[model samples]
Target: MRDEKWTARIEAGVEGLTKAEWAPDSRNILCFSEWGLRVTIWSLSTGTATYIQFPKHPDRGYAFRKDGRYFVLAERYKSKDMMGVYDCPSGYKLIRHFALPTTSLASISLSPTGNHVAAWEAASEFKVVIMNLTGQHIATFIPTDDPLLGVRHILWHPSGTYLLVGGWDSKLYILSSLEWKVVATIQLASRLPSSTACCTIHSS
Candidate 1:
């Protein structure tokens, strides 16, 4: 702070509050209510507040664009998985609201380019659904058919050319962006297999 003589007080809309965060721009604050009820955004510059209800998770259900121009939040509305995108600079205006084709959305991630969003099905299902800005379905992918497979997290590469998915089954799936195909799979294990042997590398 330029001067240590400035102070402002902000309060949550409800009594039982949980997670409180600052928007990327540092001009606004996001407060998540207890029991997944709602999120209140309090603006420091304008001294105003905005509320969004049914936040999927207090810590990980929302993401903001790198530049803070946009915000994507996952919500549960009417017993269905819904997503809302907000325009940050314009006072968190609702730019788009749409339903997702998922049973229980675990988490969501916005591509670095801000062109698409990826949502994954929660435990007991291994599904990742990608969608464009207009709410059109792009593709849904299941890395494995094992009944125990479940998606734990999903993220996009900084270049926005690849997507990385982590699973409860202990594996990582890399998907190419344009074609939306699994480019590689990285498996995690406690030890090497019996058939696997040590190898040597030679440089000439």
Candidate 2:
């Protein structure tokens, strides 16, 4: 589905775009804009759109639960740090928000069960931090090399035991949740001629 093109509109204009995930049951596409400020949930079947506005003018990051009951969103504002859970059927109301130690949020991913969240912050270097649903820090998954690669685009495996990450480095890393180690690294050929790549693990 990565190669297929869909239509979406931004504040500036409309254009063809690719999405991270499509809700099979609801026909909604979950995607963030290039700037990451606005997250749009679009209905492919009906051509309807819903826009969720962030409290602070920070970059937007989103994740969807397996059951599609709830989703998580993280925003980075200049003075106030924000993170919240939103009921999918309704609009974003505010589950939690806090003052962040830093000013930048690199990315955000939610576990398959919707019980935990993983977020990345930018400092001298990037750092991956995990938090529970109540807005409490649980642990940090620091990569051996640059954390930017793994945290840039993260997706929770179906089993919730691993995280799949890919980005500009052209390498996909499968990170183990138990030891927080990179168990497998898959590199794409330089001549693939694709701007982005994503993965989905199927069960037997």
The model with the greatest lDDT is 1
**Model 2 residue 95 CA deviation in Å:** 2.9
Question: Over the stretch 1-204, how does candidate 2's per-residue lDDT look in tens digits?
Answer: 579867664332453233446654556766555544566777666676776555332334566666776767766555555776767665434556654333567667788767777776643444666677777766666555664433446778987888776645666778787766679988867664344545555799
Clashing pairs in 1: none
Candidate 1 residue spans exceeding 4 A from truth: 1-4, 191-204
1-204: candidate 1 lDDT, tens digit per residue: 585776787665555788888889888989898888988899888888898889888888688987789899999999999999899888889999999999788888899998889998878888899998678999998865564868877878999999998898888889999799998988889567757848655799
Q: TM per model?
A: 0.87, 0.54
Q: List pairs with backbone clashes in candidate 2.
A: 36-60
